[model samples]
Target: MSKTNAARILDRLKLPYEILEYAVDPDDLAAESTAEKLGLPPEQVFKTLVARGDRHGVCLAVIPGSAQLDLKALAVLAGDRKTDTVPLKDVQPLTGYVRGGVTALGTKKAYPVYVDELMLTFETVAVSAGKRGLMLWLAPQAYLTATQGIVGAIARSSPP
Candidate 1:
């Protein structure tokens, strides 16, 4: 598989990461499904979400696959009075990645990134490799270092 922009950034930073590829299920692009395919707990797989703050414009939220982005919490972290997830159609143009492939690394623009505090509890986490069907596995600290992400309680359990 050809290296993605995200991977190239990691390479330049001299960070060690492993790229894992899986089949893409167009009908099921949920990060939870990707975790299941990789035989990992959903909590270990992080999903990147694009959100726009009323004041800050756009930022990326990295939360566990099984959790939902807490917009209010994110707003607090981003110092915005309000925040909302960007429309699906705007994701690619804003981040240069499709819906199932958004990552903080190598975005078309460098947006502030906020990662859920839960990620620190895990030794490693998996995030999109800037495209669907591929995941990058690296230590939580390594991921943070690469993205310079802020750590906060920006996630909540998904409603049943």
Candidate 2:
């Protein structure tokens, strides 16, 4: 398969990573499904979210697929009083990546990235490869370096 922008960046940086591809179910864009496909735990798979802060124009937040972003807490971390996810229609235009395939590592816009502190619990985490059906797996530190990500308690367990 051809390299995605994210893969290219990782290669250029000489950061080791594994690329995993699975069948895409357009109807099911959830990250958890992808994790299952890769034989990884849901918590090890992260999904990227784009949010607009009252003060910051836009930024990317990544959290475990099984959890949901804590917008109020993220606002505090972002130094903004409030923050909301960007509209679905605008996600592609804003980040050059459609839903189910957004990665902050190599986006159209270089927005600041914040990864959930929980990610550090694992030796490696998996994120989108900037394409549907593909995932990038690498050490958390390497991911932080590649995406310039800040680690914090940005997510909490989502209700079942």
Q: Kindly list the per-residue Cα lDDT of model 1 for residues 76-160, writing each as its tens digit.
A: 9999999999999999999999989999999999999999999999988999999899999999998999999999999999988
TM-score of every model? 0.98, 0.98
Which run of 10 residues does model 1 get worst, by summed lDDT?
A: 123-132
> Clash pairs of candidate 2?
none
Off by over 4 Å in 1: none
Clashing pairs in 1: none
Tens-digit lDDT track of model 2 for 13-59: 99999999999999999988998988999999999999999998799
How much is the lDDT of residue 156 in candidate 2? Answer: 94
